[model samples]
Target chain A: MNNRMILAAVAAALVAAAAPAAQAKDWTHVKVGIEGAFPPWNALDPQGNLTGLDVDLIKDLCTRAKVECDLQAGEWSAMIPSLNAGKFDLIMTLGINEKRKQVVDFTVPYASGVASFIVEKDGPLAKMPMTGEKLDLNDKEKADPVMKSIGEMLSGKAVGVVQSTSHEQLITAYFGKDVTLRTYKNSGERDLDLKAGRIDAGFDSGVYGATLPSKPGNEDLTIVGPQLKGAMLATEVAIGMRKGETELKEKLDAAIKSAAADGVIKTLSVKWSKLDLTPTF
Target chain B: MDFPFLYETFLTLIAALPLTLQLAATAIAFGAILALGLALCRISGILPLDWFARLYIFIFRGSPLLVQIFLIYYGLGQFREVRHSMFWFILRDPYWCAVIALMLNTAAYAAEIIRGGLLSVPHGQVEAARSCGMSPFMVFRRITLPLAVRQALPAYSNEMISMVKATSLASIITIMEVTGVAAKLISETFRAIEVFVVAGFIYLAINFVLTRLVAFVEYRLSPHMRQPAPLSAATVAGEIR
Candidate 1:
């Protein structure tokens, strides 16, 4: 009876020791996923190390949240599924949209951007009318004529956009019928196609599109057409989490709010993207 | 379970079939010619010709098809001379670039198959043909070529099926084949499994038809291999008695 009581006490002590660690709200360690190919956001540097705005922001956010972060690189296509499968606790550099919301929850947007088109400097599309205007895709009254003009200009021409992106959705919605759409797995490949003249124009984030023309071999490429916004093209860039992970989401959201409040996001944005993309809300 | 969505997905995937078939058919057709030439070079007595063929096969068959496609499509495009030259006209189009890559890759594998087939032709049959007073060309045409083709058919059919599937990679370079369309659908609906299931069905259907066609060709090519029909049950019982 004494031996039994001692065994029971030991078991109780072990359970007591393990329970709090499992139930603790403090996420001491986290696995975060980011598409390392997305430059100026999250990308690998010369020595094959992850570096960019998303990398920097996640580091700061994790530091402030008192959590150890293990940043992982993953393909954009695999992000949601992998997150849901518990491969990672959070995904950064995700664009918040209704379609994605159905599969994963998003933290408060840390940044926002518009989509635009890049074409060769001497290409036929260089003379397009709306070079710098920001057009809302949701405003049908404003968008129709602009879309029609774009369709006319790009008829029978091939346009490239990154696969599984808001840019692809916007291009498909607006000009899918008139122009040929080519979707690439990454922006680098799409940019390569653009420089090769295989694609007449490339549509993607205005910030990303701006970086392409300045590339060494891509000097001939230039950003043309209107800066596309609203609807599918305008999206709030945020971190993605599995559905029902409200605790992690809230924790990250708090970190983001603090980062924005302290201008950390703005500073990182300017450092990486060379523009201010700080979210107002 | 969503019959309407599956049907819609099927229809969308079907629209991309023509491009997929074109890539596969063009690659296989061109690859067969290149393979025949390479196989001949490999078997030729000259050291340089055989060495060139062996090295060509080694490099192409050594690398993954995706890497080859990327090198041809993107890597070559990086050169200013390539962009400025007349080859840009062909390289500038992703479709042609994919076709070229698929052809080159398939030709390497097919060359080995063809060479094996060529070597497998019975020496007795060639000797008999020559003894019958046939010229070298006539002997090759009448005996060696037919038997070698028959020997290579089964393996070549597998190669054909592989080429058909390989067309899916063209989507990576932005050609909207069946897989590309399915990927787009998945992106829109965020339902990867359903879209991919439909796309898989389409590929299965295509491969099934190709398999049947190859079987028919095999049947027609080998008349001597045909067997007599089986007797009916009653006839078999009566004969047993």
Candidate 2:
């Protein structure tokens, strides 16, 4: 037992003593990352504080779950990577989509809005065929022809969508080069640019587009295109957790179900979305 | 090492070359004029002009270009009055807004460079010109401006290169330059490394050509420095001159 050997033993003892405490430490303080640019999901208010439906919903969920939640701002493109890198514990602005599920696990849906698109009310694409219809994207046999015609009509026209979003994939997969795709980093920019006439069309959630024109001065834009749903789009929106996060996912799923059963989700959806977006489940 | 794919990516990036060139050329050309005005104001002996120039330079140079781009494109864009005002036409296009931001940013730095060049022109030479009956404007035009331009070329050329790289930030505001195209490609393909590799090579090539252009200008302008090495009779004879 020379001096170096004694120091090594002391370090080993310290680690051995600290292991239990480390295991016992509660991860009650949860960090939720939301995109401040995405409205009706999360957005920055004039005071530079995060607000919107997701912001409100996350706070409510955290209160019920008894977790100390610290909501943080993040950009959409960087959200998942930041979660994977441990910058935040969960991503909340995300709607549950299969492509995302391939990389991350999502809790049972908390709230859901239909997959929707918007065009200028009086624009050439205003008379797009799927008006007042919700096409099931899973049925390609029915969807293909309609999507093709729509794509052809929108030929040489620009569609603005968020990067890494299902809307981007949907427009690109169906239209390919027939339509010029502009992928924004988030919904606010896409909406702003669409209103500015930089883009001919924009796509996201029905609820988000519903909220855009109500912003202080953006009164001219209207959500006038097809309201799309299913397969290519997720049927519901859910909280995104890291893959293999079974314990966290299970806890969240249970919380979501309880929130739904108690009608907490419905009330919040109607309050924020201005329509009933409650999951049937 | 996928030659076909790499070749395709190269073609796609080259397709964006016109926009990249347009941004850099437009910004630098306008930036030079603005830089001249700013440099003159800093030396104009007017207290307010000098202070305003100092403040403008301090703020633009002190902040990151990305932050400034966002402040102009997104931050000020948040205001309803800004959206409705006459300035909206200029601020409406992301391309023009990007050019304005890049030009203003470059001018701030270039102004300082030009000011240094002007200050370095020998005072005795200007005094001698004045004593020889040259007007103040003539003294500046004959002795000051040319010398300052020659002195400023090296730093000014560096600023030009900086503007070329700075144009990449325009992608954030949705102007589809090389990086924006690369981002869209990667999002669709999910091949970040492959797309960025091709994009990086395009940037490298652009910078390389720009470096050559600057070197050519430097060589041509400093003709006295490039004159055939004293034209020794032995060397001339060897060369059959």
Candidate 3:
């Protein structure tokens, strides 16, 4: 009897010690939201599956952090609100900007890109000087001349841009009353309008603009204006979380930092965007 | 309460009101004519005409307005034949595409309303008119048309107000109306609630004025139903004495 009691106490102690270890190995499943509409960063493939640089990077980051991730696609306008409402744990491919930072916490940037204009190959504005120049919109002196020339060239012409993007802001602020600004909900619609000759020009990311001319049936389209960066057009794109989610934000930041250092982001960027968009930091 | 910001946003949104009103006005005007024609076809007693009218109404009424707008704007543009055709000129512009979609959608609902009105015209009245030696055209002009229009006015007014609100969907296809400008403002300020509030008030004001105008027209058209003015207190007292 005495021997049996001693054995039973030892077994209970062993079981208690192993229970916590089992719990520690349990994975934390995170629900991630992504706008699978923007190409090269995030977009739906021909099979209706999410495939892009952001998708690849997020999967890698989640794997490295050992967190089980459930990725879902959402509309761009509803992303931040849904994140705040606890619909998702994090939003991938969010462009870091001052206005957005006021509402959500951001991880370290994973990629950066510039914005530009796409126009018909033989369009009126296509002949404008500064076809491939990189203009820093933050510099008024340098940006003003480009703005003046673009304004004169595009006056009374209809320009299409995605709504709620820096592209719309840039056109509205610079062109003002000189041009008719049409705002679309997504890039695909704007691209359609551009191809159909409904709009004289369309504004989008330089990476996307560069890819358009090469697309089958898009031979008439070409990047016509300067590659715009800085100012309202944010350079860095990162994952966004609801404010006060320090633990998740920290984990995401670390994962992104490691991914950048290990060249994972660079590999994905080159594969998707045909350029290295790995942020320096 | 951020009155200044609201005022500023209101001013910005107001600038786009003309586009909204223009879309609504154009769609409503064209839709009314199409509705009348469809209603006539439905009542014409011809099998093919009635079937065509039924199919047109079913397709437009069954689908969502947004889908209709997208199909006309984006989906139609996808076909090479559409792009190369003469209709491309009209289909190419987002504004016209939106108007065409809205007009078609509204016409479907309006045709049903007008059809109900036409049916509601008393058969006895038509028989009486025919017995009195009135010609078919004369009877239709003097009796059927007037009574049908009056019967349809109340429902038609509701459709008109809805058409005004539907104009906001045009923004999805890149037409900058009041809602489009509000969306742009929200994007810039990141104050979605405030910008939308101002936009709501602008729409309310427009609809309020429109409602009153519709009510006045309804009152004017139904003069035979108006009641005599009530007696004043002095007149009542004098009558009692």
How high is each candidate's interface RMSD, in Å? 8.9, 9.2, 12.3
How would you encode candidate 2's per-residue C-alpha lDDT over A6-37 as one tens digit per residue? 87788678645743221222558888998898
- Each candidate's B-chain TM-score, in sequence, is 0.92, 0.90, 0.91
Candidate that scores best on TM-score: 1
Model 3: per-residue Cα lDDT over A1-281, one tens digit each: 69967777776676456422211223389899988988877889788789888888889999888798999988776677677667887898777777788878898888887888898888777886677888888898998888798899899998888776667777888899999988777887788888887888998888887776776888888898787888777667878887766777777788888988999988999998888888877
How much is A256 displaced in model 3, in angstroms?
Answer: 2.4
Which segments of model 1 are wrong by more than 4 Å?
A: A1-26, A138-144, B1-7, B228-241
How would you encode candidate 3's per-residue C-alpha lDDT over B1-241 as one tens digit per residue?
4566889998899999999999999999999999999999999999999999999999999999999998888899888899999999899877899999999999999999999999999999999999999999999988898999999999999999999999999977777899888877766665677799899999999999999999999899998898967889999999999
Candidate 1: TM of chain A? 0.88
Question: Which tens-of-lDDT digit does each residue in A8-109 have in candidate 1?
Answer: 778678645743222235578899999898777878878878998889999999987878999998888777767766788898878887778887889999
- Each model's TM-score for chain A is 0.88, 0.86, 0.85
Model 1: how far residue A263 lies from native, Å: 1.3
Candidate whose DockQ is highest: 1
True contacts kept of 2: 0.19
TM-score of chain B of 1: 0.92
Each prediction's whole-model lDDT (CA): 0.86, 0.80, 0.85
Per-model TM values vs. the true structure: 0.87, 0.77, 0.84
**Model 2 chain B — which ten-residue stretch has the worst lDDT?**
B185-194
